[model samples]
Target: VEMMENVSKYRYANVPNLDAQVVEIPYADGRLSMVMMLPNREGLHSLQTLFRDLSYSPLASTLASLRETELLLQIPKFSIESKLNLRPTLEALGIKDIFGFDANLSGILAGKSAQIGSVLHDAKIEVNEQGTVAAAVTGISVIPLMGSTMDTFRADRPFLFAIVDQSTGSMIFAGRVVQPTWAAPSPLG
Candidate 1:
């Protein structure tokens, strides 16, 4: 497979640079594949935009080569949002039949546990190894009164909403909120 060939080449190259050129090769199965080191969010976005622009280039051979080849894009764990954006970007590049997992499914595919609570009730604070006060983490807790009855309070999780570039793995914007609002759709949800 193209992916396997790219892995072999990567193993052979001893001193690869951060922004190395993409490699192309023809496989025994008569298929072409392009291999390149994955870029950060900005770089990925730039590449997507560039491909979109070149989709209708006059150079038929270049365009044909791109059309015939498969791509293996690698990404780290934290770049989920950016990866999500790649779908629309690919569509803009004239790629009509692309496939990928949705955010929640992708998380499970990547072996990440999904957050399944409706409310964050208790918050715990601690210091990290760097000696800085770690951000408060929220959990669920319940308290009971001696005489009257049961009462509970819903708390907020310590997380921020962030916009990211899918290609190059960059956080474009971020904001914190008091509660989980439905204003934005969460892939995790």
Candidate 2:
């Protein structure tokens, strides 16, 4: 575990639908940022449910309403590396063809019969007192309305966070931090 202590002005909101608070912390240049969505009360089930029903339109509307305020923030320092094979999840969503023999991706492969072998996704995120540093690889893959005075946010419990390109309104990396622990040394390391 690492220490997190800071006080600054940031964009923030509290959503009634999700019963959570979201705080956006910008990176050095200000065009990119890390957004932390944390439940006001204990437990992440409500936040998880909100994510399941998430869509761009609702998210945009929520973000568009955030207000600026001075925040006293404390977020734990943590790091995580996760990899997922999307085949099963995709199949469950009625996308079975891509992983089967009958699949046809010829349009992109120029008539060569092809099917996906393994859809691998890897993601990583790290956060500390200064800001957040995060990255996600091999993956293709908010909100609220509120106006308040000085705010205090402490991410000592489970929370979901994201790194985004503010200029393009594009998400670069996102993950949940349920518990902070030291990561085992990577095989490559």
Candidate 3:
């Protein structure tokens, strides 16, 4: 709570598009970026279900249509550490032998049969008032409010995000924040 109190708050335009609202923060050199996707209160479930479809066209479209509005940005400060066991998920996708006894990796190791014992993916992220605690460049934009009346975009609930390489437009990291926190970060985060 003390950390949250000192966060540098900003008021900008918060445009609402189709299913979710978005904000893109580019890296200092424009070679990397972070994109935040906050879904409508009612669209959370649908967004989660659709996130796995590599072609995030719907998300792209919504971002391209942003029109800036009033926003009270106060994303809570949090850190996440997670591990994912990919053996099961991979096998289900038809990637079997690598984790089975029948695996054949002899070319790399002449006489030894090398089979993957386990596949573990570990990731960590921290976001606070200063910015994302990541090992890359990312940029941010502040859109001024157009009129006296303004809308707010506060990320106090579940939201999705991605860290991408702008040069190649490849996602380096992606996940959701179902319950943003330091101690109990969600796997989605």
Reference-based lDDT, each prediction: 0.25, 0.66, 0.56
Q: Over the full model, what C-alpha lDDT does candidate 1 score relative to the true structure?
A: 0.25
Tell me which of candidates 2 and 3 scores higher on lDDT: 2
lDDT of 1 at 60: 29
Sort by TM-score, best first.
2, 3, 1
Please give, for residues 1-189, the per-residue lDDT of candidate 1 as tens digits.
Answer: 001101111111111222222222222232322222222223335445434433453222222233222222121111112113454555678754324232253434477634322222332221121111011111211123356322111111112223333343343443222222223211110
The sequence of per-residue lDDT tens digits that candidate 2 reaches over residues 16-46 is 7657788887776778888888878666675
| Cand. 2 Cα-lDDT | 0.66
In the predicted model 1, the residue pairs found to clash are 40-168, 40-169, 41-168, 41-169, 44-167, 82-166
The TM-score leader among the candidates is 2
TM-score of each: 0.19, 0.65, 0.62
- Per-residue lDDT of candidate 3, residues 57-161 (tens digit): 654454455554334344556577889999899999999988888888888778997899888999987675355522222234343456734344446667778
Candidate 2: which stretches are off by over 4 Å? 49-57, 87-117, 129-149, 180-189
Minimum summed lDDT over a 10-residue window in model 1 is located at: 1-10
Give candidate 3 misplaced runs (Cα > 4 Å): 1-17, 40-57, 66-72, 129-152, 180-189
Between prediction 1 and prediction 3, the one with superior lDDT is: 3
Number of the candidate with higher TM-score, 1 or 3 = 3
Using lDDT as the measure, the top candidate is 2
